[model samples]
Target: MTKPHRHASHPKLVARLKRAEGHLRSVVEMIEAERPCLEVATQLQAVESAIRNAKQALIHDHLDHCLDADSSEHDRAELKAITRFL
Candidate 1:
């Protein structure tokens, strides 16, 4: 197998993941503070969406760079592994 190349968008994807982590921490803080259920739920939803978006971006980058570097057989196996996250 060829060495997997890093995607150009890797930094952006990492930034997004960091932002999602911060958002998750905020949600934990909100729960500890005993904030209203509605407010807490809303923040949780935002965190979830951010994480999902980050996952999608990472998957896109993987498909774009990693898959391009692989043979058809390897790509099929890699794609199966990647789709498991979805």
Candidate 2:
């Protein structure tokens, strides 16, 4: 099989995801420490937003840079699949 195509934005996407991961860890810590519900919820919301943004950015990057005239039926199907997250 061919290697997966790498996009110019992959590094930025990875960094975005890492930041989300850090936020998630903080959320877990807050929950463990029995922080106020509102505070925990706010942090959780931030984590969710970070993850969602990263996903959307990655999807957009893929759609912009991965597809081409030579793309196959499977690539089209994959694009449709990824959009379900949004």
Candidate 3:
């Protein structure tokens, strides 16, 4: 049987996605407004940080659920590989 994919339970994941969406919209606005390169770069960095936070939240959930539920040696190795990214 195939295992179910687990998702992060934190509200922060939703907030991160919303923030990214807003950031993208802001980027578009910046381009339209002819904003400075430095200002745009700052906004891009904020979006990158938000995405990283989302990734960490997902990794936390995976470690708690999928990693904990698996019993096989290969699963252990895969879990280690994934957790190493965190």
Best lDDT among the predictions, by candidate number: 2
User: What does candidate 2's lDDT look like per residue over 7-85, in tens digits?
Assistant: 8898988998999899899889999999999999999999889888888888888778877878899888887787898
List ranges where model 2 is wrong by over 4 Å: none
- Return the TM-score for each candidate structure: 0.83, 0.87, 0.72
Better of 1 and 2 by TM-score: 2
lDDT of 3 at 22: 92
Residue-level error in angstroms, candidate 1, position 17: 1.0
Candidate ordering by lDDT (highest first) = 2, 1, 3
lDDT of each: 0.83, 0.85, 0.79
Question: Over the full model, what C-alpha lDDT does candidate 3 score relative to the true structure?
Answer: 0.79
- Candidate 1 lDDT over 1-86, as tens digits, reads 25656778988988988998998999999999999999999999998999888898888777766665445887788788887886
Tell me the lDDT of model 2 at 5.
Answer: 72
Q: Lowest-scoring 10 consecutive residues by lDDT in candidate 1? A: 62-71
lDDT per residue (tens digit) for residues 1-86 in model 3: 14665364767678778879898899889978999989998988888888888888887776777755546888888777887777
Clash number by candidate, in order: 0, 0, 0
